[model samples]
Target: MVQCLSHRVELAFKDAMKKAPLYSKVYSLMDELFKFYHKSAKQSAGLKSSFEALNITPCTPTRVGGTRWLGHTLTALNNIWKGYTAIVKHLSQVSVTTGQSATQPKALYLLKLLRSNDVITFAHFLTDVVAVLAQLSKALQKRETCLYEVHQQLLATISNIKKFQTRPGPELRKVQRPDGSFAGESLTGDTTQHSAQMPKLLTALVETLDRRFSDIDEGVLCATKLADMNAWPASLEDSTNG
Candidate 1:
């Protein structure tokens, strides 16, 4: 049952993300960027060199496996966020060094996409959103967790996510300008079209959570809380008096 709930939540998140235009593109880009380096020893070497040149610690991008769930996606996004400069640098070098080869054009295209405001904004937003979902995913997998605790945690997660409608995540806040445009290296300072989409995406996710968990009997789960001694009255007199 625990595993089933976990899978259901992850699938719900995936569905929500895929249906959101901004999120879908950013997610796909993450997978594409990882593969760009994964399939090429030369590009991987270039990425390492870029890291060294920029005095950043070397780390490889993680594969966003189709079946691995949101935790893996979080890791992949973290990798991209941490190594964004290194990736841009590597791609810049590849575009020039590869001359007229097909690799140069592909490298240039990816560089353009990665540096855009929409990708940057939505990618950071997802990093924050998925980080929350990933926490619930981890908690649900614990051996000692009970259905009552799971119920509480699910409610808490939904509440936390709804807050994102007004409060942007730490990562997403970094690139946003006061005027509603986004500012970052190579970004064109255009008003972020993606920021508007965040609320809709979050709403969809909350709805999905509600729909998916609707069948669970909250009253039954509440009753199970009595199994915990901590949930019991401190003394028999208190219980009888109540």
Candidate 2:
């Protein structure tokens, strides 16, 4: 039952993100990019070569699919973020490869989409958000986790995600200046509009979490904490009076 609830929350998160245009586009592009290399031996080899050239460890792109759990989604996002430079280089080289003219335009388009400031920002932001969700999901699946523990962890995860409204995650902070300006080589244009969308995205996520978990009996869950011996009153008289 706990594992099921966790999956429901993750699905709610995906639904909420799909409602946002920026996130929708970013995730779609991630899936497309993964498929672009995944379908071809030549492209995959070129990507590995690019990784080697840049001194990045060779790793395959993981697909972001609807059927995947949040942990898999997080892995896919992290893979993309880590291979950002190598992916760009590989795509650039592939776009000019001879005899692969048909793949050239597609590769170039994916490259252009991946390099957009909005895409870069939200991609990193998602990695951070999903990381939190993934951890919660992993915890809830543990055999030792009880109802009260699940409730506590769920609330804690929500609180941590809400903090993103004011303070962006480490991955996001790396590409953003203290003054709220874009600070990376991948970003060149004014991203004020895109940056403004982050809070709204986080709002959607928090609201979804609250709504999805509403069915869980919080009062009952809280009451379960009393079962813990550590939560008992120190004196027998105090316990009797209570």
Candidate 3:
């Protein structure tokens, strides 16, 4: 650990002009901050808290089998992930009680959904991740594209449920004129009637989504911003040192 820390410092000072280049540029500052994060990850709670305070997201390098940063990320995320699964189970139980179909198995569905999705292009992708994450912890990023998509899906479902509840009830059809002729009554008369409180139920469902998903969006935005903040320094470092 000490050797890693020493090399890191030596490398920075070895090229101080290149790394900190007297300009006080925003990108340069971000570059320095990013370095601090890489080291902090291994040290103490300070790393996590500082990054959280700054709302920065640490970028795990893509090289396989390099440092343990990715492993730590997985660990941190898995802890949250476990809690997320429990939340899904709880929600599913509620769905069963209300006779609503459970969403396709949460983990598999989410993984499949992302297979056809882009991580950086659309905000909805971020929203979906955050919405799932919210049952456990809040993200530091906001994914409007993601949140908006969820909102749209939910709104559509609410509309369908509303129509189901409001279509002309059979009872109104049972009424007859003072004369002997009955109203146009379908003799089978056994259509499944929706609960009168369905509109209210639909409204409650929409409200719940609004509250829960809204927070996820906030988390996505914050997390993304943090990552960017951490990335800026690295970006500038690469550009200058190159």
TM-score of each: 0.87, 0.86, 0.19
Worst 10 residues of 3 by lDDT: 117-126
| Full-model lDDT for every candidate | 0.79, 0.77, 0.31
* Candidates by TM-score, descending order: 1, 2, 3
Question: Candidate 1, residues 1-242: lDDT per residue as tens digits?
Answer: 78777877897797677557877667667777888889988788989999999899987788886654788999998888788888888888788983549688788777777877777778888888999999998888788778777777888899989989989889888877664433335574453568667887899899888877776656775576666566579899989987
Clashing pairs in 2: none
Query: Which candidate has the top score in lDDT?
Result: 1
User: Which is superior by lDDT, 2 or 3?
Assistant: 2
For model 1, where is the 10-residue window of minimal lDDT?
Answer: 180-189
Q: List the residue pairs that clash in candidate 1.
A: none
Instruction: Report the alpha-carbon TM-score of model 1 versus the true structure.
Output: 0.87
Cα RMSD (Å) per model?
3.3, 3.3, 26.6
**Which candidate, 1 or 2, would have the higher TM-score against the true structure?**
1
Q: Worst 10-residue stretch by lDDT in candidate 2?
A: 179-188
219-242 per-residue lDDT for model 3 (tens digits)? 553354343333355676786986
Clashes per model (N, Cα, C within 3 A): 0, 0, 20
* Candidate 2 lDDT over residue span 1-242, tens digit each: 87777687787787668546777767777788888889998889989999899898987788876553787788887787778788888888888879888899998888777767777777778888888888888887777888767667778898999988888888887766644333234454556646777777788888888787776656765587666566689999989999
